[model samples]
Target: MTSFADLDLADVEEVAERREELLAAVRDHAGRIAYHIARVDGGDYGQRSFSTDDGEWTVKYEAGDLEYLRFEPRGGGETYVISTQQPAEPKALAEALEDYPAFVAAYNDYVDSLAGMLDSVEASFPQVESTESVVTERDRIVEAIEACCDRMAGELRRYEGTEYGSFAARIDGTRWELKWDEDGASYLRAGGSGGVYVLSQYGPPSAADVREYAPRFGGFVDAYNDHVAELELDLETITFET
Candidate 1:
């Protein structure tokens, strides 16, 4: 995965060209998969199970978006990019279509590689019986961050009419509002300037609760920073210049 810290748009033109090509290829490949689904399911975007050498393979696409491709044995697989339509800009769309063949060949190679891995993996780690849904550490972390952000939003709602420190409620647009909790934790909610916020409790400097929460708060900030790095998003600037 690309990180925000490692992302540099110095070669914007070249990168954009490659991105369009990749997207176009995925869209075309999706159409080919849809063709196979049409034989039985009439090409509708839904799950279709087919027989493979190892076992059954299930492909699913919802609302024209490719969701997942899972094979038998360990029920392991990978998800593909979502594609609905071509870009409105003609030149960019043309660039993507031009690299369609390259994308298809690469995608085929990836599928073949995954199939080989699955065959080997089945011999190495047999499937365990379980009725419970598996929750990974990554999933838990993502959920925690989401819950924290939601709490921040709730705080904004709870204290929108109140004042806190130098921050005041300011509505920029229909859904964009800036406010802070009663405890002085400021928040920029909705619109383009959105981010997670947490309260800083009002009390004496040496308060016991404050000291305890300080490190936890730092951890929360670090988690957000990690998420930003994982996504390769520019926390300071929200724009993509062409």
Candidate 2:
């Protein structure tokens, strides 16, 4: 049996093709032995046995071992076993059994070759980001946005009057705006200068709006993060300038 452990590359399809050919040869040899046994028996002693090609018996290897041979009759019956003590009657079957160990070694070699190939293929793949890392990044972005909003709130407090007031910030070419009127009604926008408001409320600006419209910001964060990742930029390095 050939060993593939030291090979840098092994073609899985080629290994499988060789495996099938070797297995087929084993089955063919078993079939020939069954034919000879049936011919010599000639339906004697009322045993309704015939050649394997006649569909009377099927030759198969034992699962896992592949070295053990057995003949199963059609429609389910006892497995046919030839006695080694009566070597003259079923000499071919006994002789074939002796050659099965070599077949077993070859079959196992193919299995190992395919397994090594699978390992190589998997190792060559790029490592994917884990769920923990993804969630941590999202949380970091959210925290940064929240911190920027907190600073904006502090600046907005300076304009506490019955008049229209607005504060705007720019981060990484994206603009975020917060506007309030005499009635303390406020709205927020995060996009281009002319982008539509993302959050609008009749009363004063509340942190609850951030929670309620979190899905909206989450989508924005995902898109922004993707862009930054493609540019090989760090999200933490981005800051809002009001």
Candidate 3:
């Protein structure tokens, strides 16, 4: 997502309040304290784009004297903010130690949480890595996909000769052709899983008004062809569910 150093304070004008607090703390501590704002890159901020619609937000404080904190509302309300500086309040020996330990612990937890968020965001929406894993995984998925396409060819022909049968095939992420007949013709497609299956009459209708009762065709295809404007799967695992 975004990098730590790359974060712009002006972009998150809302944090001006905390910035004011950090500034006051820096001034109060003066030469005894060192304050530099470090950005909150990677992790929660980047993985999940903050939303102004929902009310979920998180405050991530920076380590050391550079008191940085970010308020992120990735759920709905302007998600995620980050900044750096020292602890805002003076502490007695016990409180100072407690605060220091607490800060350290919180920072560590933030780091861990950020790591998990990175993993989750990656899982939900994968990033095309440009490193070594890129080529290796790409090749792996490509070979698997190629083998699948090859199989589809023969499988397609088998269905072609079958009597009034159907199959589902994907074209990118957009559309799928619910095909029938030895000759290419009509198909059904949708957006994602169980989106909507609309029949387009390319050839003859296997059974006219097929949608009236059930999706019937001479061949099979993914119900969501039109929705697959582009192919997003760098790695695809295909299993004939039905």
Candidate 4:
């Protein structure tokens, strides 16, 4: 599976730049608040604008008290939670600045992990390299397989009141199946209108049974590829009838 090191050089640099920019913005916001308090000494109030990864933020002050913070996103995504209108406590701004980077980092890690999942899926279930008209349909199926894998990897939660045998992710027009027993063994099968692939029974699934399952598929594919390589297999070894 590809790691962060394998990501495009430009992409990594971009993330670094974004992180730095956010930190700077947080500091600038804090500085503005401090300046207001100093200049007015309980007699001043104003607003300071700062940039964030999502959008521009306006920190408001009233009579040397932190009044509120508002964000207007560049991408127009809803800001889930805004600042409370009540006066913010001392050091609250410092704490917010301190946590800003950590929160962004956590979300970035999550997205990276999902991308890794897609890479693993492609690695495990490689598509045939061909240019024939017959191969075109197979290519489409391969794309669907990738999409399904990505969606599944993005969400690993089990539905409450749902049985252990249920798989959480499925693409429309594709069939997905999961079978498990009390002994901790499970099997996953997906495809149809896409392409057929089966993962034989594996045991001791981890982390809500989703994390271990994806890796298991990747491991199985890797092992199969190694075996095929050792056998010196080639496309010429197979005969197609149609």
Against the hidden reference, what TM-scores do the models get?
A: 0.22, 0.22, 0.18, 0.21
Clashes of 1: 2
TM-score, ranked from best to worst: 1, 2, 4, 3
Candidate 3, residues 1-242, lDDT tens digits: the string is: 11123335465553445445544543344212222112445222222112223232233223423333223222322211223433332211112222232333444555566555555454456676665654555445434433443444445556355634454554343434344444432334444455444434433222222233132221222322222322334225445666
Candidate 3 global CA lDDT score: 0.35
Model 1 TM-score on a 0 to 1 scale: 0.22
Question: Model 2 segments beyond 4 Å from truth?
Answer: 1-130, 162-165, 169-174, 179-188, 193-242
User: What lDDT score goes with residue 199 in model 1?
Assistant: 33
lDDT on C-alpha atoms for all candidate structures: 0.44, 0.45, 0.35, 0.44
Quote model 4's TM-score. Answer: 0.21
Candidate 1 on 1-242: residue-level lDDT in tens? 12122325566676566556655655566656755454445555687554433344455766554665443432443223333433333333333334334444444554565555545444556678762333343334434434564555454445344444222222332132334444433443333344322232231222332333333543444443464464455545667789
Per residue, candidate 4 scores C-alpha lDDT tens digits across 47-90 of 65556564555556666555555545565532311244432222
lDDT of 2 at 92: 31
Which has the greatest lDDT? 2
Pairs that collide in candidate 1 are 4-232, 38-43
RMSD of 1: 26.1
lDDT of 2 by residue, 67-95 (tens): 22444433453333332222211223333
lDDT of 1 at 153: 45
What local lDDT score does residue 98 receive in model 4, on the 0 to 100 scale? 40
- lDDT measured at residue 215 in model 2 versus the true structure, 0 to 100: 55
